[model samples]
Target: MDFETVIGLEVHAQMLTDTKIFCSCSTKFGGTPNSHTCPVCLGMPGVLPVLNKKVVEYAMKMALATNCEINKSCEFARKNYFYPDLPKGYQISQYAYPIAEHGYVLLDVNGEQKKIGITRIHMEEDAGKLIHDEHNPVSYVDLNRTGVPLIEIVSEPDMRSPEEAADYLKRLHEILVYLEICDGNMEEGSFRCDANVSIRPRGQKEFGTRTELKNMNSFRNVQRALEYEIKRQQYLVENGGTVVQETRLWDDAQGATNSMRSKEEAHDYRYFPDPDLVPILVDDAWVEKIKADLPELPLAKRERFVNEYQIPAYDAGVLTADKTLALYYEEVVKLCGKPKVASNWLMGDVMRFLNEDKRSIRECPIKTESLAEMIKLIDEGAISGKMAKEVVEDMYKTGKSPQDIIKEKGLVQITDEGELIKTITSIIEANQAQAAEYRSGKEKVFGFFVGQVMKATKGKANPQLVNELLKKMLAG
Candidate 1:
């Protein structure tokens, strides 16, 4: 029988606070191992854990961004577990009452919109890292990441395909980064995902025994892991073997999943409210303040880009994927008053440079005003579209204006009608046979004449004037 895949992603976004969630240690990514650890995070006796106000505020912003209902009062629980990295031998998390719940994020998959349900968005503390010595075969623990603030966004098992899961993860990542609450760096382990995937008969309502997948650090690997797991489970069922409920690790190099351990049930953690900390109370006034302070979300900004700027939906999606790039597009449009032109350059050249260099839009070499000036030059016919690419590259490399670049390199477009006709006439004389074919009603040879004229002018001749001059010279 044919089967379908079900997936739910549990994402942890490390809050962009200056310090740890329950302690004052630095929340920076790369620090001396165990240097950020303190008595509170080290689980020392007689030390009290103090809550960070910024963590709550950032969590509220994320919860609100995802359309979650905030619980005014919530408490933290002790998730009892033993691990070498978990210094406290238990994790501080939310259980019976979390900060928010019953929310959803909308994803556009293959031109169709789907709302992925968010089961909850809760605050939690991160565990430390365990580094193993490759040569010595000894393991050492690093507690620098201990007590780092994290907001876990759990999704309902509403995804049917790996593509949908990837789309959902991307949308969530965008939202978090756009809110300025999370850096959304997957490689740094700031933003991570644990996928729960299972396959069952296509028409069945009940889900099959699900396996939790971990260690998928990148988005590409997440989708790959899920696809592999689906096929593995399907193969098992077809061979009359039952699928096991367990946690698996995705080996990206091998492109497969290996059983990590038996998946523990919720009760296995044996959660209980922590006595050292008090419950967090978020009043309506506080919630309203955060809501008012929220930035324009991705969906709203995308719609505005299409409706107000008159760009295509695809352009809007690409531009609004990152908040800074979207802002950059608007600044260029304001200066050039050409939305499509701005969208094309931003989505094309701007994105290409940023991706190639592994840089963010904020760190872009070409300033927004510089890009606007280059685009405006194209509009004014000061340079051809082909010339604009060079101008933009110069702007990126030397941080120079388009005017300066054009003046220095003599890259200005040859828009003079007189000069274009002189070149166009010489080209027709060279391609006399094709010109004769054109004069005798072979319209296909028209393109050959145009190509020769552009070649003669070295692509600097104004294309419109070139075409006009070519047709005028060839027809005669």
Candidate 2:
């Protein structure tokens, strides 16, 4: 029988807060292990946890951006568990009443828009990391990540394919980054995903035995792991074998999922309200203020770029994919007042340079205004497009303005018609056969004459001027 895949993502995004979720410990990543811990985060006896107000604000911003309903009253609950990484044994998280619920994020998969339902977005604390020795059978636990503020965004099982799930995750990551709540850095474990995947009969209404896959740190891994899991489940069901409902870990190197343990339910965690932390009361004024402060999300900004700036949808989508890139594009457009040109340069040369150097837009060597100035030079016939590309390479290396480099390197285009004619005349005199070929209806040989002129002038002659002079001179 044909089968269908059902997938839902549980994303845990570490909030961009200065302090831990419930304690005054530092929320910074990549510090000496156990250095960022505090008495409360360490679960010391007689220590009471206090909620960080900034975490609430950050979570509210994300919820408002995702169009979720913020609960007026929510409280923290202790999720009892035992792990070396979790010093508290019971993590402080929201159980009965989460901060936001019933939100939806729109995703475009191959030009078809679909809304993925968000079941809940709750605030929680992150567990520490476990570092295992490669050669020895020993494990080390780093508590630095413990108590770090996290927003667990749980999605409904509405995605049917891995592509949809990947798109949903991308959209949600963009939202989190746009809201300034999360950095969305999967490399540093700032943003991670847990995929719950299952396979059922094509037309069945009920879900099959689902397996939870964790340890997906990147978008590609999420897609690959889901693809592997779906096939694995389908094979099991097809051969009259029972698919177990368990938690699995994605072995990225092996490109497969391994059974970790049985999936835990709410009852298994024995969740209870934390008495130390008071119930959060979000008022209308607070929610409204956060909504007002929300930045223009990726979708709205992309649409605006297409409509207002008259750029293509693909260009707008790419420029608005990252918050910094979008800001940089907008700033360059403001300086040059040419949206399409700016988009071309940004999407082509700027992105190329960034990728080659493994740098982000924020770390770009050339400033937005500098790039605008370079484009302005090319627009006013001060330099040829080819020459401008050379100038851009120099600017990338030396961080100099276009004019400064043009003057210092004497890279200005020779636009004088008289000078170009003299060079073309020299080329025609030297290459008589080619000129005869051009006169005998061999129109393609004109390019040879242009190349000769460019070479004679050491490539300083303006290509447009040469083409114009060559066509006029060769017509006779």
Candidate 3:
């Protein structure tokens, strides 16, 4: 039976707030296991949890950015659970009423736009981490991450393939990072995903039994886990075996899913409105203010780059993938007034250098002004493209201006027509055999003469002038 895969992702992004959601404890990652804990986060008696205003504001920013509708009044509920990591028997989260709902993000799937529905975006407090002793039968709890601010963006089961799911996750991750609300670090547990995947016979109306997958730390892992889970369910159903509804952990090393436990529904959590915390009331003025402060999102920026700058859609997508990189490209274009040229250099050599060193655009050694100056040099014929490649590398290594690098290396282009003609005339005389073959209509030998000219000029000859002068001198 042909089966179709269904996927939905629940992403929990840690808000970049200084303190935990319900307490003043530090929300910094990697402190002494429990050093960041306080009376409130530790859930000590007689402590009343206070809601952090920054958390609410950050949630609002994401809600608005994702086109979610913010509720005027929302309340927090206690999710009853017990684990070594969860210090409080109940986690404070939004259940019955959430901060936002009914949002959608568009994905470009195979040259078509597909909209994925967002069920809800709710604010929740993160639980602590449990580290088990390697050689002992003991486990330790780190309450540092406990009570950290989290906004869970729940997507509807609208994705039909693993690629779509990955694309959707990337879009959300990009938005969170662009909004500056989350660092979007997957490995650090700042940005995480839990996938609910299932498979059913194609054209079936009702959905199949879905299994929740956890422990996928990266986007590739998420897509891989989903792909594996879909096949697992399909094989089970095809072989007349029942598909189980369970929470599974992705064994990344073994590349399979292991059953963790039974999946739990909302009622299993025993949610109730917290009596101590008051309800949140968002005003229109606050929503408008957040909307006003929202940055141009990735899709809009990409489209503008294509239309305004007249670059390719692929180029625009690569340039606008990151906010900082997009800003850097814009600055380069502004300085050089060569949008496509700037895009090529940035997308080509500049990005290659950064990726090779595993550095972000913020850590780039070549300043935007320096890159623009190099592109201008290329446009002004002050240097050939081949020479500019070496100069750009030097600029990256030494953090110097392109002009200085050009002067230091004495790599100026030999664009003088007279000088290039003289060199080309001598090249034709020296390589008379190859030049004779060229005159005899062995046109491929023309490249040999061009190579000789470049070698004769030590790669300083203007490539365009070389080609023009070589064609004329060889014909003679």
Overlapping backbone residue pairs in candidate 3 total 0
Which structure is stronger by lDDT: 1 or 3?
3
Candidate 1 regions off by >4 Å?
Answer: 134-138, 262-267, 418-459, 469-476
**Leading candidate by TM-score:** 3
RMSD of 3: 2.2
lDDT of 2 by residue, 242-344 (tens): 7988888999999999997653553488899999999999999999898898899999999999998999999999999999999999999999989999999
lDDT of each: 0.91, 0.90, 0.92
Local lDDT at 132 for model 3: 88
For model 3 the TM-score comes to 0.94
After superposition, the stretches of candidate 3 with alpha carbons farther than 4 Å from their true spots are 262-267, 424-449, 470-476
Q: Give candidate 1's error at residue 318 in angstroms.
A: 0.8
Clashes of each: 0, 0, 0
Q: Comparing 1 and 2 by TM-score, which wins? A: 2
